[model samples]
Each structure stands twice: as structure tokens, then as C-alpha cells.
Target: MGNIPDHDSYIAAAPEAFRPVLNHLRDLLRGALPDAEEMVAYNMPGFRIRGKVVASYAAFSKQIGLYFLAPAISDHAGEIAETGLTASKTGVTFPPHKPVPDHLVKRLANASIKHVDD
Candidate 1:
């Protein structure tokens, strides 16, 4: 992808296998953070609140990543582990066959929104 301007374009430019996953994640984020301003930053789709990015999502060759603040990941460590998804200090990554659950995504998004200023 080269300088994608928005989520629609970013998703369209992604690998065909990942488009649906990206779209699902986008809807989840929008619902979870209705007050957020949608934008593309760092060449990825993200949601911002009060000018601070609270959540973002990206698709790689083999997996999709949903990124939030570090504290949100840490806070949900146990839940993420139970889901058998891979997570770092700032994000969760899962193969297309094993997506992060929708409920979990919403929880993490809400947590990220809450901690936007941290």
C-alpha cells in the first residue's frame, strides 16, 4: 500500500484474504468508540479521541493486528491468553483462522478510549 488516505482505501488495498477481517475490525472500532475521529496514521487506519490515537488496526501477510495503548493490552492479558491469541504490550495479532473475539475487541477499544490521555 502506498500512502493510503482512509480506511476504505486501506482495506481495498489490502490482500484479498484480509479485506473482510479488516472491515470487521473497522466496524467494531467504530461501534466501540463512536466519539472517535477516524484517520489513517503511520499508514494504518486508526481512531482518535481528543487528537490522541486510541486504537488502530492493520493486516499483515499472515495475520491481522489490533493495536491499543500498552495499558489496555496489559490490563486484558488474562482474557487474551484465554482466547489463545498472540499479544504484545501494545497490540494483539492473530491469524485469519483465529481472530480476536468481537467482545474482546470491543472491550479493548473501550479501554483504549478510557486511557487516551495516559
Candidate 2:
């Protein structure tokens, strides 16, 4: 993403088709992790708490990926499956047209924060 400095720039640099989805995810994460520090890590916009990254989102050519701690992803596996999205041990990839549900995003963000705090 070319050394983007913040979420705004990262979203601005993303493909037009994915901008709204990225913005929406950013909002969801921000609200869910209000104490988190907003930063660009690994070239992606992410939320960090107590020196640990709790959540992050990125835009790609074909899909948007929402990343969280591996335990958070595993804990919510069933909810993610219900959304019909593909997920790895640490993230979920979904097309912009069918973004992950906002409630689920918030839940995952909180779970991720808890995982790190513990």
C-alpha cells in the first residue's frame, strides 16, 4: 500500500470499488476498540491496544481482509461461517459486495482485544 500513514490514506489509496467497505470496516473497528491506537502496520490500517494489535483491515484486488488474533478468529469460526465468507486462522476475506456483518466485526474486534489483554 506504499507506506500509507493512516487509515484515511490507506482507504484513499485502495481501489475505488473497495473504499466504502474499507471505510465501514474502519468505523466498526474504531468503535469497537475505542482505546486502541490507530496505526499502519505491515502496510495495513490496524488497531492496537497496550502495544498489541487487536484488529486490522486491508483491501486487495479481489477481496477485503479483516484480520484479528488467531484465537479470536477461531473463537468466532461459526459466526464467520454463517456469513459465508472464507477465513483463515487469523483473518476473514470477503468481497466488497458481501462484506462481513457489522455486528460480527464488532464482536471479533472485541474478542481480539480481549485475547491480547489476557
Error of 2 at 33 (Å): 0.4
lDDT of 2 by residue, 1-118 (tens): 6999999999999999999999889888989999999999989999999999989999988999999999999999999998899999999999899999999998899889878857
Q: Write the per-residue lDDT of candidate 1 for residues 1-118, one digit (tens) a residue.
A: 7899999999999999898889999999999999999999989999999999999999888899999988889999999999988999999999987888999999999888779877
lDDT of each: 0.93, 0.92
Where is model 1 poorest over a 10-residue stretch in terms of lDDT?
109-118
> How many residue pairs in model 2 have overlapping backbones?
0
Candidate 1 deviant stretches above 4 angstroms: none
